[model samples]
Target chain A: MAETIEMDDRTIAIGKNHKLFDVERIRADFPILHQRIHGKPLAYLDNAATSQKPKVVIDAISHYYQAQNANIHRGVYYLSEVATQAYEQARECVRSFLNAASTEEIIFTRGATEGINLVAHSYGRRFIQQGDEVIITTMDHHSNIVPWQILCEEKGAQLRVVPIDDHGELMMDEYASLLSAKTKLVAFGHISNSLGTINPIEKIIQMAHQVGAVVVVDGAQAAPHTPIDVQALDVDFYAFSGHKVFGPTGIGALYGKEKWLDAMPPYQGGGDMIKSVTLEKTIYNDLPYKFEAGTPHISGGIAMAKALDYVGQIGYPQIEAYENDLLNCATEALQKVDGLRIVGTAQHKASVVSFVLESVHPHDVGTILDREGIAIRTGHHCTQPVMDRFHIPATSRASFAFYNTKEEIDRLVEALHKVVRMFQ
Target chain B: MDTDLRDLYQEIILDHNKNPKNFHKLDPASHSAEGYNPLCGDKINVYLQVEDGKIVDIGFEGSGCAISKASASVMTTIVKNKTVEEVKALFEKFKGLVTGKVEPDMLELGKLAVFAGVRDYPSRAKCATLSWHTVMAALNSKEEQAIVSTE
Candidate 1:
C-alpha cells in the first residue's frame, strides 16, 4: 500500500518501496570503503562528518562535467540549455526530497553554515530589532550558534540558550519557559551533531509558532539519517548540507517558507539573482533565485539530486531501521569496554556514539583507532559548548550509516581494548 | 607493541602521565601563562618562579592526553633552574624533535627525547608541545594565551 503524508494545507502521496535493500549490495556501491588502511580493512565510521558517495552519484557528476558543463540560467546554445534544465531539475529534486511546498522555496547555499547565516542576516536585519530575544539550544553546532550570535550582536538583540540535561537531552521545560512574545527567532538543530539527540522539532516548531518567533531548524545532521517533511513540521526555515547526505561537498539547500522568503532580502548580490539591473536601482529576481547568486555549483547540484534519488530508491524507513540496528550493535559493544563512559546517551538518539575512556584521551583513542583502520571522529565536534557542559576535553565519536556492519563495531571494540592495554 | 608506540609512550612518559611530576601550581610564581589546544579542548596553566635570568621552580596545572600531560610534567622537571635563553633554545629543539625537522641525539634530549616518536604522528605533535609553547608565552611576555592547534 502507498503512503500519504497529511500536511497543514495539503496532502502529498508517496510511492511504495519495491526493492530488497541488501547491505552487502549497498556496501559494494561505495568504492572508497573497499580499500585497506594500515594493513587492515577500512571501517569508515565518520559518517557524521561526511558520507561516502555511491558510484552512480559519482558517475552522474562526472557525466555532467564531461558532457553538460555550461553556465546555467543565461543560456544561448544547446549545452547551456541542457545545463539550465539539469540545474532547475536538481532544485525540483531537492524540493521534493525535503517535501517543500514548491521549488521556488528552495535556495542553493554553500552548505548548512551558509544557510543559517543567510537567515540570521536576511531575517534578522529586517525582523529582529533591538532587545528582541533569540533562543538556541546548548547542543547546536557552531554553524547554528555563531551566525545568530553575530546577528544578535549586530541587532542589539539578546541571544538566550536552552540548556541540556546530563543525558544530552534538551531541557524541554526550560525551552518552553524560554518562549515569550519578545522571542523573535528560535534556532535549534533537529539532531545534535555531537550527541545525536533527535530533538522534538514538531513540538519545537509548534511552540515557536505560538510565540510568533520564526524557527530555523538545522537539519544538517538529521537530513541523512531521517526523512524530513518541511510542510509536516511546518518549520519556517530548514537547512542541511548535501555532502553529509552522500552528495558532493560545497553544495546544500535552504528551504524557507514562501512568506518568509518574500519578506527577507537577498543574502548576496551577484549574477543570476536579479530580474533586471539599472544604473540607479536594480530589480531583484523572484523567490529562490533571489537568494542564489553567482554561477552555482552545477555539478554538485546534479550529483546531489542523484544522491537524493539513491536514498529515495532505498527509502528512509529501510535506512533508519538498518542504522538503528548498527547503532544498537555499537552501543552494546562499547559498553563491554572497561571504564568507557559514553558522553551522549540520549533516550532518543541517532547512529552517533560519542564516549570517553577512563584515563585515556579521545585524541589518543582516535590515533590508535586509525592504526586499526577505524576512522572515528575525535574532538569537540564543533560543539565546544557541549564539551564544556560535560566537563570534558573531547569525546571519540563513531557515527554509522546504513551500509556499516556490526562486524565493524567489533573491530572498533577490539581496537579500543588495544588502546586500554597500550595505556596500561 | 610497535616501536612507534613504544617510543611515543615510554615508561617515563607513562609514569608522568599517570603520576605527573610537579603537577601542582607554584604559588607565588613570578610568571605564568595559560595554554589551550582548541582541537581537543586541552588546557594547561604554566607557572614558573624566575630569579634573575634563571627559572628557580616551574609547575603546571591542567588536563590533557597522556602525551600533553606527560610532556608538561617532563618540561617542568627539565626547564627548572635553566636560564630563559636556554629554555627558549630547548623549546626550539623540542619543536624540531616533534616536527621531524631535526633528528638530534636522543641522549642530548635526556628525558625529553621520549617525544621523538610523536614526529611520525603529525596529529599528536601539538599535544607533545602545547605546554612548551605556553612556557614561551610566559617567558617572552607574548600573548595572553598560547593556543596550539594541530590542524
Candidate 2:
C-alpha cells in the first residue's frame, strides 16, 4: 500500500513495496559492505565515485583469467577460439544493455574520458572547422568540457556554454539561443554528478538535431541509475564507465550510431584494428575494432557484461523507486539540521545529496564523518564550474547505491549532528 | 576517537582559525606568492616584507578548511621579525612534524606543537604545509609572481 509521509512541511508518497524491494538481499550480494571502518559499521555512501562489485561480477573476472586466457581474433588454437567467442559475446551483451541496433555500434574504451577523446579526435578533425561552434552546458563534467575545449582550440571553433538556473536546471531558452546552423557538436552529461540533476536528454537531442549538430552524452552517472536505449534517444554517441556500474575499472562502452561510426576515421591503429598492413599502405578493420587499439582489457570486458546482467536482474523500476524514496528521506532529514543548506534542489533529481554547513567547511565535515565510518565524497566532484556557480568552495556529497539502507542514512544524519555540535 | 579528533582540532587551533592573525594583504609587501591545493580547492597567499636579512612584516590572505587556515594564520604570527635563516629552519622543523619525521616537542614548537596530530591524516599534511611553501616561494622569488600547487 502507498503511504504518505509528512516530512515537516512537505508530504512524500512512497510507492508500495519500495520498502519491500528486498534491499538486504541486494546488500548480501556485495561482499565489501559487511565490514568495519574506524571502529564502526562501514557506511559506503560514495557510490558515485565507484560502486561496490557484486560477487557474480567478481567471480566472472577470476573465471575469465583462470580458464579462458588467450589472445582474441588473431589466434586459431582452441583456447584462442574460446577467448575470442567470450569477448565477442561480451560485446553483444553490452549492445543489448544499451539496446543498440547492432554490436558494431559499441566500442570498448578505457573509460568515458577516452570515449570522449576518441570522438573529439576523429569526428572533430573531419567535421569541425574555423568559426564553428561547439555547445556544452555549465553542468558538464570536466571530462565532457575539456575534450570539446581541446577540439575547439584545434579547429579554431568557438565553444559556447548553456547556463543553468538557480534551481540547477538548464535554461532551455539559452540553449536554444546557442544553437544555430554553425553549431557542429553539442556535448553534455546525461546527469550532473555534483547536483544530481537529470537533464531532458530526449529534448536536448531533438534540439541539437534541428541545428544538424551531433549530440554526445557522458552517461557515466546515468547508466547505473536508469535504463538507457540508444535507439530510443537517437543520441549520436553515448559513453559510460564500467567501474561506476558495479564493474571493473579501466573498461567502458561507447555507443555510436552506425552511420556516425562508419563515417568517423579510426581513433588509433594497432595489431587488431587492421585489415592488412603493408609497407606502403594500411587499411583499418571493421566498425568497433577500428576504435579499439592495442591489447584491450579482456577480463574487464567480460566482467562488465556480468555487472550489467546483475543490474538487469534487479530491474531499473525497482531501483529507481527505492532510491527516490531514500533521496527524499535524506533531503528532508538534512533540511531539519540547523544552519545546513543543500546545494541542488532540482525539480527532478537522482539519489545524490550535496550539502554544506554554515560554519563548518566540507573538508572538516568529511573528516569528522570519516571517524564515524561514513564515507561521503568531499570537494568539487570534478565539477569546479558547478561549485563556482553555487559560490561555494566545496560540498560534502552522500551518493547512494541500491544496497544502501535507510538506517545508514540515519547514521549519517546522527554523525552530521555530532559534527555540527563539535564545530559549534 | 573523540580524543584523537580533539588532538587535531585543539582549542588553540580553533581560536587561530576563528580569529586569524595577520589575515590580510601587506599593502607594500616586498614579495608575495600564492599556494593552491587542487584536491580540495584550498587556496592561500603569503606576503612578506624583508629588510636586510630579517623579515620586517608578514601576512596572509585566503579561504580554506580549519587546518589550512589556522596553519597559515599561526605561521604569519610566528615568522614575523625572525631572520630568514631561522624561518627556513622552522619550515623544515614544521614539515618534519607534520610528516612524522620529527617528534613534536613542546620546547621546539611551543604553540605550533598542536599540529603533530596531522601525521595521522596523510592527506591533510599538504593542507597544513601549503602556506609555508608559498612563504618560501615569496622569499626566493626575484621579480616574477610566485605560485605553488599541492597536487
Candidate 3:
C-alpha cells in the first residue's frame, strides 16, 4: 500500500514493500553520497562518527522551518498548535520505535551524552549514597565513563570497572562477581563504538536487577544497527543519539521506566518542566516533561521522526542482513593484507571494522586514504580505556551502513595495499 | 598518488621516521618537556642539554605518525649547538612553514621546508608542530612543567 504524509503545505507519497533491498537505490536517497572528493568517488566508511542524512530527513527539517515554525506547548495560535503536534508526535514515534511502555517514559535529550548525564544527576542524587558502587566496563565510550566518574567523585562512592578480554568482549563472569549489595548502578554501551562488539546487554540488565542495581544503557551505536525493545530487555534506562541513526544532530531520546522517573528529582528547571512555580516553591511537571526543560530543538525533533520513518520503511531485518554481508566482506578483505591486524574480533559484531598495519600509524593511513577520497576514522574513537586494554595507540576504523557496498569495501582493500606498499 | 601526498611523505621523512636521528632520552638532561596530542594519540618527550645559553645537545623519544616523528628527529639536528634565541626564531619559521602563514622561500627554512605540504591538510599540521611546541616549552620554563597538550 502507498502512504501519503501531509505536512500542512507539502504532501509526500511513500510506497511500502514495493521493492527489495537495493544498495544503489538506497545510496541514491542520500545526496551527499553522489559528490566526488579529490577526483575520486567518495567511499564514506565513517558511519560510526556520524551518519549522512537522507534527502527526506533534510527536507523534513527545511519543511519544519519553512511552514511549521512556532513555539510549542505554550502557544495557542494555529502555527503553534501544528508545531506542538509535530513535536509530541515525534515523541510517540520514539516511544513506538523503542517499544517503551508509555509516551511519558520517553524524554527528549541533546544526545546520548545528555541522557546519561540526566540519570547520573537526578537518580544518582536521589539513590546513590556514600560508599555505594557504580559499575562500568573497560569498553565504554567516554560519555558513559565520565558521567559516572563525576557522580562517584561527588557522592564519595567508588567506581568499579568490568574488564574486557583480548577479543574486546566484556568478561561477563567478572561483571557478575563485581555486583553486590553495594552496587547502586551499572552503565554500559549496547555496542562498542571502536571495536564493533555487540554486548550481551539483556543478560547484563537481568544481573543488575538481581542486585537491586539500576542499569543505564548507552544505545547510541546499537540503534542504527539493531532493534531496541525497552520492555523486552527490562532495561531501566536506554539512551540513543539522533545523528547516529541518520537523524539530525543535537537531538536524541532517553527511555526510562516510570517508577524510577517518578522517584527521581527533576533533571533541569525551566518553563515547560514545571506545573506551577513561585518564589518560595515550585511543583514539577509529570514524567517526561520533568526531565525536559525550556524550549527544545523543535525542528530537530520533528525531522528525527522522519528519519526514524525512513529507517522503518527499510526494515531492520533487511538492513542488518545487508550490513552483515558488508562487514564480512570487509573483514576478509582487510585480513588478506600483509601485516594487517584487525582489532576487536568479538563473537558478535556490528558493521564496524578496526585494523592496524605493522609499520604504518593509523593517522598516516587515514591521510593516504583521504587522497583516494575514502573517509575513515583514525584514533581512539573516544574509547581511551579500550585503547589501553588492547595496548594499541590507535586504530583505523571503517564503519558501514546499509547504503555502503561491496565495491566500496574492495576499494578500501586496494587502497590498503597501497598503504602497505608505501610503508614497506 | 597525488603530488600533495607524495610531497607530504617524502623520502627524507620516511628515512627520519624509520630511523630517527637523536631518537633517545638525554641522560642527565637539564631541561625536558613532554608533548602529547590526545586526539592523534601522539606522545613524545623532548630532552635538551643547555650550556652558556646555548642548546648543546637535543634528543627526543616517543610514538607518533611519520610527520611527527620526522619533525621531532629533524628538530633535534637543527637546534643542537644553536643559541636559545636562534632556536626560538627557527621554531617561528617552522610553525609558519606548516601553518601556511609564511611563504617557504621567504625564510631560510633549510630541511624544514619539507613540511610545507602540511598546510594543505589542516588536521595534520598539528602533528608536524607538536614536538616544536614541546621543545619551546622545555626551553622557556625554568622548572619542568606538566606535559604540554596539543589539543
Candidate 4:
C-alpha cells in the first residue's frame, strides 16, 4: 500500500503549497515519465489528450489477464464468475466515482465518444421528436456535437448551439434564452478541452431541468481533473473516458439516472444484452447492459477501477490545488515572453494553457518545443467552433495533471522562450 | 516528444515558412481558389495569373502552419513561369512526394523538394498538400464554381 498523506482544512484553504504531492515521488509512479525524448527529459504537458497511467492501473490489467481471463456473464465456471464479479465491481466503482445512485445506472462504453453516441441514439432518438431542439455549446468536443447533430438530423429535430464569449466561457444568458418548450435535450461539456474552461454545469443542468429538457454532460475533461458528483449536480446523463482519467484507452463509462436509462431503447443489439431471443422478437436486458452490447473491454474496465482508486487516494481537492498552481505558474511565465498571447482567460478554468506567439506558427512552436522534449498539443484541438469564435486558426495547448510540477512548467516556459526567440 | 523535427520541420521548410515567397493575393488574377483544412484550421487562397497557357504570376495569402505556408511558398515558386500542363505535373509530383508515392529528388524538385520530409509524418501531409490541392482547384475552376473543396 502507498503511504497516504493527510491534508487538513487549513492546508486546503491555503492553496497548493502543501507538500502532499512530492513531484519526484509522483513521477516515480509513472514509468513513462523517466525516459528521454530527444536527449532531454520528457516534459509531458498533453494531459488533455490523455493522461499517463500509474503502475497500479497497469498492474491491474496485467494481473487480470494472468489470473482471471474469461468471458463475463455467460459461463458458469469459476474463472467466468470471477471475471463477472470483477467487471461488476468495476461498474460499482464507477458508480461511486461519479456518485451515481446504483451500478445499474453506469454503462461501460468504448470511450467518451461512444458514451455520447449511446445517449444520443438510445435516449435522444427515442424521446426527441420532430421540430424539437437539442441545445449544445460551441465549446463542446466534436464527439458531443456530431452525435447530437446526427441524431437531430435523423429525428428532424433542430440543433441549437450556445455560443461562447472571447474568454471562452459559455454565455449563460444565451443558453437560458435558447431553452424553450421545443428543447428536448441540452448537451454540454463539463470542461472545455481546447480552452480548459470549466463550465457552470450545475447551473446549466438546473436551467435545462427547469425547461423539462434532459441534460447530458460530457465529463471527458472534467472527470480527470475534478471530483464528479452526478447526484449532487442532478445531471440526466454524464459521460467520460477512462483513458483521459489515466486508465486504459478502450474503456469509459456513461452515467444516467435509472429512470431515464430504463425508459430509453437499447443502443446496440448483441448476445449479452439479450434477456430472451425468439424467432418473432427478442427481449432486451435491463438498464446498463441494454446499452453495453458486445463483450466489453473486460481488463480495461477492471483497470479503470484501479485508476479511479489511484485518483481517489490522491484526493481531488489536493490534485486540483496542485494543478491550479501549475496553471498559474505556466501562465505567468509564458506571459513574460515577448509576443506571447495566452488564449482562454476564463474566470474559472482547469490546468490548460493555450497560447500563440505572434508571427510564430503553432506547429513551429510545437516542433521547436519537441526538440526540448516538451510535449504539447498544437492544433485546433477538435473544437473548430471555438477556434472560429477566437478568429485564430490554432493555438498551442499545454495541459497539466496532478502529477505535474513547477519544474516541468519552468521547462515548458524555457522552451517557449527559445521557440519565440528562434521565430523572432 | 523528439519525433524527428527533420521529418516534420526541415530547415529549408522553416526558412520558407519564415520568409514565404509570393505571399500576397494576386489582384486581377484569372483564377483564384481557397482551400481549408478543417482538421487544423489551415486556410489558404491560391491566386493564379494565367496568361495564355502559362502561369505568368502566382501568389497566395492565408494563415496556417509552417508546413502549409512553406508548401504554398514552394508551390508558387515551382508553378510560376511553367505551362499549365507542367504546373499540373509538378502538383502531382509534389503530392506524390509528400504522400510517399515518390521519393523526392532534390535535383528534380529544386527548392520544393524540401517538403519530402513531410512523408514521414502522415498527419501533416495535408498541410503540405493544401497548396497543391488549392492550385489544382484554381486551375480547374470555371466562373460557376467559387469554392473547391475544404478537407
> Per-candidate DockQ versus the true complex?
0.80, 0.74, 0.80, 0.54
Clashing pairs in 4: none
Q: Estimate, for each residue in A292-385, the C-alpha lDDT of model 4 and write its tens digit.
A: 7879999999999999999998778878877888888888888998999988999999999898889887877876787788899999998888
- Steric clash pairs (candidate 2): none
In what order do the candidates fall by DockQ, top score first? Answer: 1, 3, 2, 4
Q: For candidate 4, give the docking quality class from DockQ.
A: medium
- lDDT by residue (tens digit), candidate 4, B117-136: 77876777888888888888
Task: Encode model 3's per-residue lDDT on A319-350: one tens digit a residue.
Answer: 88778878998999999999999999999999
Could you give candidate 2's per-residue lDDT for residues A9-106 as a string of tens digits? 12223355543467777889999999999889999999989999999999999998899999898888999899889989999999999999999999
The candidate, 2 or 3, that scores higher on DockQ is 3
Q: Per-residue CA lDDT of candidate 3, range B21-53, in tens? A: 999898889999999999889999999999999
Give the whole-model CA lDDT for all candidates, comma-separated.
0.90, 0.90, 0.92, 0.87
The superposed Cα distance between candidate 3 and the true structure at residue A311, in angstroms, equals 0.8
Candidate 4 stretches with Cα past 4 Å from truth are A1-19, B1-15, B27-30, B92-103, B114-123, B140-151
Write the residue-wise lDDT of candidate 1 on B28-130 in tens digits.
8888888888888889899888899999999899999889999999999999889999999888999999999998777878878888889988888999989
Model 3 residue A78 CA deviation (Å) reads 0.4
Q: Candidate 2, what DockQ?
A: 0.74
Interface residue Cα RMSD of candidate 3 after superposition: 0.8
